[model samples]
Target: MNKQKLLIILAFFSIYFVWGSTYLFNKIAVSELPPLFLAAIRFSMAGILILVIAKLLKKSIKITRQQFLNSTIAGFLFLVYGNGVFVWALKYVDTGFAALLASTQPLFVLFLLRLIDGKKMQKKSIIGVGLGLLGMYLLVSQKTIATSEGMVLGIFMMLSCVLSWSYGSVFVSKADLPKNFLVSTGYQMFISSVLLIFCSLAFKEDISTIKTISYKVQMAVVFLILFGSIVAFTAFNYLLKVVSPEKVSTSAYVNPVVALFLGWYFLDEKLTNQSIIATFVLLTGVYFITSRKRIAKQKVRPSQKT
Candidate 1:
């Protein structure tokens, strides 16, 4: 195969396996570290690493003023509220279940397109929205989950994170960003890291805890920074440019399955029958929504899962 073809295959593996594994990594990391602090560190370190790599490659890190503001907004939505808050929710929710909930992003994107862009939802998309809602209700309304302490709040906050990510997806499409995709990603991570630091302090998270963090949590964070944030994300952007978005969006289907399996196998998180059924229903809806020809035609980057 040509080098380009080989890279595409490797990129697909990175996104499919690496992005999926991030949920498990985040779940492991959050067991000891404060969620906001953990995310701030991950993003800050990953952002710096990315910028350094970009500079070594002679890519420009400069952006227009409007681009800077847009990057900050995107950073807040995608990284701070979207990812940071989602990690906080993971403290209560199971890693697998959280991945299932996040699978609804395409559904959220479909709704946002209709509401904000005044675009009409096609028949497939409408049916997708219906199934998506049903799947969500079934997933969260389980008796066991509802009875757990703080789970209700966790579920609510996780949904809010999905909304934040959905809105960020829409915002990014219209926003003026750095010409280089890697640079834009770096800025988003860097800017969001700053915001997350403030969030950690505002919540009075003990910063000193990092001094005693376990080897496991430290390794998880390192994996998240290198594989999740940098490698998988670069793969995602690369795939977006080379492959059809429809093909790239297939990660949505694979990621949750990978997360669910890893959580079950490694973390021993239970997988109930309802969750299994909900996964099927929810992913089917996501398929219906994203399979629309017009949506597939647009270069809509589905935000990172973890």
Candidate 2:
């Protein structure tokens, strides 16, 4: 209803749809481009675009040495480990299973937060997390991810990516980065770009001719850079600061529904009744986590009740 709440809601939509759709775009981009290099270039371009916007707005881009270090750490954690590995894993797994595996991110986040800081959660949230995990398993269990080699390795790698992303998401909250969130995000993306490019070169990933890549693929890459990196990612960072990390992690739950539907509609991937049921259950968990029931504060005289 209010502007702040409205903005938060809009932010949720940005990450929910924008980042969710990126799985489809990523499939397109990596079909031609080298996965690590593709991610490196995408984030690098997005980082520069964000910096330019920040400069145009006259936002302070200055930061302390510690902030820069923090950005570098987050950069490696989120982008290099989380996203780069994820893109590579996609080659070995189908879209349905990939999104479902990645959706375990919130569970990892919950465990990490509790393990690191002993942050206790309400029973409702724990229940939500449990139901989400079970629902995702049921959704993707029937899907075929075994058509490729290294299926077990792919599963481990995807789960590792989830942990990397979850930890990075939580760490940023305490990383003492720049006050200007955009500036901080720019630094992180830039730092990750450097690391990723280094890895790409180390692996000698061959880059094909731009002319060989289709126009649709190129546009998908551009969409990933602009919307996924700049808009949705910035919104995610904002959400982390304002909301609980567990709550922010609900993107994992919502993302699969979008990714699954888009995969079915565009790529002719299977859409099963089991998957539909999973979506409903996943969304219900997200609802439980994100929705806050307002409780009226009761004012009572001292003599009324103990």
Candidate 3:
């Protein structure tokens, strides 16, 4: 295989495994740590580590003010609202359910892009969006809809997380990002981490709670910081430069499968036949939506008659 193919494979493996495991890790970590506080520390540490390495390599850290402003918005949307609500929702929902809801982000992005950018949605993409939503409905309806106010609120919060992530993705594709993807991402993380810390403090999270958590939870947090944030994100950015954005975006589809499996195997979460059917429908939808544009672009032109 060529170098580009190898990088794509690496990217797939990174996102597939790392992100699949993050749901479980987030569930485990939040059991002991405050969700926002834990996220704050994880991203803050990762950002500092990236900056240190960039400085050592003499990489450019200077970005235009516009780029910095854009990064801040991306970070707030992607990290503060996206990841923050994700962690918060874990307190009320199972890992599998959270992953399932989060997987809807790509579908949301497709519709949002069509509306905001005036990109025409192909029939295939529309079909995909429909199937994905149907799958979500089936998945959620299988469970006795939680009647408790807290559970209802948690579900809405998770949906908000998905919307935030979807909006952030659209902005990332259109924003005036720095020339260096890594540097841009590093700055975003740094800013988001700071904001998360303040948010955590305002919510009155007790840092002392960390000491009471099991060692397994601590290890989970470490894994999230090292693999999920640092390694997986690095691979994602690398793949964006080499592959079509659509291809890289397929990770959204693949990740939920991994999360479901991990949740079942390690956490002993039950997956009903309905869940299996939903996965099939959702995957089929994602494949169609993501590939439709490429298929459209490849149509042969009509010959001119003389």
Winning model by TM-score: 1
Runs of candidate 1 exceeding 4 Å displacement: none
Regarding TM-score, does 1 or 3 come out ahead?
Answer: 1
lDDT tens digits, residue span 133-226, model 3: 8987787776454554466677788888788787787777678877676687789889999999899999999978977889999899889888
Where does candidate 2 stray beyond 4 Å?
1-13, 139-143, 146-151, 209-211, 235-251, 286-306
Candidate 1, residues 1-306, lDDT tens digits: the string is: 999999999999998999999999999998889999999999999999999999999999988999999999999999999999999999999988888888899888887888898988889888888988999988988999878999899989999999999989999888889988889999999999999999999999988889998999989999999999999999998998898888888898789999999999999999999999999988888888888778765546674578
Query: In lDDT terms, how accurate is model 3?
Result: 0.77
Q: Which residue pairs show backbone clashes in model 3? A: none
Pick by lDDT: which candidate is best? 1
What TM-score should be assigned to candidate 1?
Answer: 0.97
Spell out the clash pairs found in candidate 2: none
Once fitted onto the true fold, the runs of candidate 3 whose alpha carbons sit more than 4 angstroms away are 1-8, 147-149, 294-306
lDDT of each: 0.90, 0.74, 0.77
> What tens-digit string does per-residue lDDT give for candidate 2 at 8-56?
9999898788878888888878888888988898889989899888899
